[model samples]
Target: MPNPSSTSSPYPLPEEIRNLLADVETFVADTLRGENLSKKAKEKRESLIKKIKDVKSIYLQDFQDKGDTEDGEEYDDPFAGPPDTVSLASERYDKDDEAHSEGNQFPPIAAQDLPFVLKAGYLEKRRKDHSFLGFEWQKRWCALSKTVFYYYGSDKDKQQKGEFSIDGYNVRMNNTLRKDGKKDCCFEISAPDKRIYQFTAASPKDAEEWVQQLNFVLQDMGSDVIPEDDDERGELYDDVDHPLPTSSPPASSQPIDDEIYEELPEEEEDNVPAQVEEQRKMNQD
Candidate 1:
């Protein structure tokens, strides 16, 4: 370490260097005064200011070269160093290639490809109000049904001429009907091309099987009847239970009555003035 008293100048820095030092000091002071500075940033700024001051002090002192040598050559600076340009370029190139490859890849399949459908067996049970599987079973059925619909129903030939039908007997309680008589449940089938087919089934499973067989026959005949939208197909099953709306009823023009006015007597000009004058007098008093 060099002795501080050995220096001729009382100040560590010369006049010009002192001015530069003063500017740096003022800048550091103002930055430290900033309220928004984070603790880490304040510490970093303080460290940097100290380093700058140390470098300035060394430059101002003009101390004789210590001539610290490494194999007869002066020591080279470590901090003021050049980066490895070649390595940086290689990394950048790799990132660009990865981005290009990702951009060219195919898009993922849409979630709408999966549709809901009731299992044929489940539908049979539901029709008769029989004990059936729970919600998890229904969900599993939907997944399997979607797979089957996509695999068999989506075929162009099957979709064009295939048909779906359901049949199950439902008992109706009517005040006018005889207690012993049961209503017949008719089977109705609609082909993709708007053709209708009818059949009778003793049970729900039988009805579903009949429809499946019909679908197979249509596929064998090169008829197409697959649904275009999976979501739309799911909606079809839901809407089957609900009655469709007919045309809306026409609007009616009706006059509304004024209840407050109805209680008042027929207006007379003198009576109105007297009432108003009496109310005004009461308020003033």
Candidate 2:
């Protein structure tokens, strides 16, 4: 039998193919945040990651819709009535004590603790840092529950990295670029306490979809407000030409030493521009 905790498609996949997919998914999830890879490697990695996510999303939706395994076998519920009780006389006398003990041990679910996902996917969130990167935008597996926004390092991560209540928060498209570099397709969530959480989507359409979903939930919760216009987003909303430096440091920024230039291998030196352009296009995509 397949592990119940593992994600499985409603349509049966060959064991070899399924294992290969799982390995690729694990590799992509584990290496996505690493910055040590070459530009070409990074581009390929991101592309593979996107494909994996798309496949996972499709399979998950199908699994939910089908609501059964391909084998068509019915699985027994473990929560069904017990086959037998320990003792009828002991149970009669201890039922009240057991109930009281359970009540004290487990509290009722809170009103704000809705754990079902309304929307979920990958998104990059800006976080402060004191390192050379200055500020970093890191990708996370994000989910929006009823009144909470939760994030994890990966979709398969059991423990959440963090979460916040969005009861009175407002979400809007705010495409402001940071001091480090430009980030397009961005949005901001303004908390009731004046804290702002920023996130960048893979595309403008995606960013708008996230904003719309959040707006719908907020409106239902009595936050009646409209998303801000593009002009209000930021000064850099339309400025897409200039982006962060990629591949390697520009020649002007390099040390003015002839020996450094002479030491560069001919093959590596010639491919820098092409590599940079490839990375640029990947980022734009």
Highest lDDT: which candidate?
2
- Per-residue lDDT of model 2, residues 1-285, tens digit only: 343336555675354443355445434544244346789988898787666554544455443333332223121111122211111111222223334322222232322343787888888765532112112345567889777777655576544545667777888988664422234588898865445678888778888999999988888778355545668666466455566557876687656666577667776879999999999999999
lDDT of 1 by residue, 1-285 (tens): 243334244444353544344344434543244346788988987786666545544443332221211112211111232211111222223224334332222222222333454333211011111111111000001112322321111122122111122222112212221111111322344434432323334444555564555454444345356534668888888899786978664444222235445545555554898999999999999
Residue runs of model 1 more than 4 Å from their true location after superposition:
1-14, 56-285
- In the order shown, what is each candidate's alpha-carbon RMSD? 34.7, 31.7
At residue 161, give the lDDT of candidate 2. Answer: 47
Evaluated at residue 110, the lDDT of candidate 2 is 28
Q: Which ten residues in a row have the lowest lDDT in candidate 2?
A: 82-91
User: What are the Cα lDDT values of the candidates?
Assistant: 0.34, 0.56
Q: What is the lDDT of residue 101 in candidate 1?
A: 30
TM-score of 1: 0.16
| Candidate 2 residue pairs in clash (backbone atoms < 3 Å) | none
